[model samples]
Target: MSQSPAPARRRRGNARGEQTRSVLLAAAVRAFADRGFHGTSTRDIALAADMSPAVMYAHYATKEDLLFELSLDGHRSVQVLLDAEVGRHASNTDRLRAAASCFGQWHAEFHTQARVVQYELNALTAEHLAEVTVLRRAIQGLFGDLIRAGVDEGVFQVADAEMTAMSLTSLGIDVARWYRPTGAWTPEQIGHHHGRLALRAVGVAD
Candidate 1:
């Protein structure tokens, strides 16, 4: 005998499940960004996502897991953007500017995710935090190396290569906190503005 056709209700439930998962993730990003990992609850996230707490838990096992996922995803995005920028251009100055621009633009566009990833990182467990730290350091080192390259080429001047890299990263990272899409400047404009400022921070002329 032939098998019976699949139930329409089952397919609809699967589609709804996927949609709920997306909403929960987005809401978790915002809630965790505004409130620390410990401050947020499954109910808060569920309400923000327009789903019930049961639905939220259906997708995420715990608040810590959500935070871990967000942090991991954010770090991966930063790494990919920085790596692509470094690979795309040969000049150290250009590479550095591209990296800064990419970072700034990303922060502007994904401010909630950036903020959640940056501010709530401490909430992660030791092992998870350590893994995230490695990714963070690698991204920082990429910029540090680019700064060092600029200094060696005499295209940029800096008091300290490592410190300058930190400063540059801070400049981009803080954009997520203050940037507003509805404000006067667009992400590209903000990125370019900061990129130029970063160039000057290393003693490059306008």
Candidate 2:
């Protein structure tokens, strides 16, 4: 029947749509990072991606939607990275160190992307920022939980696990602001330094 082919056609169309959406998001991240959300326009993103502004509008209603998508996706990625690393390690110290290292490395590796995602949230709609904050909290909780576990296991000696976690997370979050690929330190090196510092922040001695 003709109706049977409709579902298959829809599936193919959806796949193509998703691919286009991905390209738009990628372009938006670069534009937002280089120009900031307030400076980037729908036409700017379209030009950067080599697509028509109409195409971008087809995928997103406005520039804010594009920025929101990038922010949410980037934050989700950080959470996924932490979750994967957390499950691979047994000891609290190893897990905590790995989390810090992972976050730092990612921030550096995707500095442009991180810059827009971390710094451009002020441009998001109030509702959108609230949605993004949920992911931010999850990321913070990931660090907090590991620090607490380390404290309970006697592997760490922090007075307050929560504040220590924030300090540790800051090491990497701040990297997005100042990290340069041509800098004195490589992403891996930065990761290692921050990981060790995080351990120390939690009172890990050695």
Candidate 3:
């Protein structure tokens, strides 16, 4: 027999718990991005979320858990974009453009989270750092494959696939550090601009 579903109150509680977790995550991302992980405290995160420290603790076991969640989330987002773009595009040049645009757009929109993931990763424990490092490597591998495809297809002329990928990733990731939404360019515009720049960097004719 099928077991009964959770009670209404229990379901509501679960939803509320998820909402609280998201709030804490956003708060933690902002705090860590602004204050550095070593400087930000649980109370600071709680106040940023407009929730008490006890409430924040109810959702996350520790600050390390929050950092891990943010790191994993950022890595997963990049991986998702890479998987979708690579699966959908056929032309090597188009694949590279799609990947670069998607990456740039993500950094522009989620600058705070991106900054935390990129800069504050060193604050995690060795075990957590190892896990995050693996995820980061997987994301880099996707881009490296795209670079190799571009070279193999003769669409791009590059000296080294690994170095080219690193340069491309850095170009996109650095947008998070200085990009401003109120600036002259929208995220889409910035993505397109950087997409062209990335193509040019790899010797793809515009």
Find the candidate with the highest TM-score and give its number.
Answer: 2
Give the per-residue Cα lDDT of candidate 3 at 65.
88
Which tens-of-lDDT digit does each residue in 1-206 have in candidate 2? 00000010111357789778878888988888888888888999999989999998888899998877778777887887788877898888889988998899888888888888888888999999999999888899989999888888888898898988788777789899999999999888988888898887877764
Candidate 2 segments exceeding 4 Å error: 1-13
Winner by TM-score between candidate 3 and candidate 2: 2
**Best of the two (1, 3) by lDDT:** 3
Q: lDDT by residue for model 3 over 37-81, one digit each (tens)?
A: 999999999999999999987777799889988888887778766
The TM-score measured for candidate 1 stands at: 0.85
What TM-score, over all chains together, does every model reach? 0.85, 0.91, 0.89
Q: How far in Å is the alpha carbon of 161 misplaced in model 2? A: 1.2
Model 3: lDDT to the true structure:
0.81
The lDDT values for all models are 0.80, 0.82, 0.81
Clashes of each: 0, 0, 0
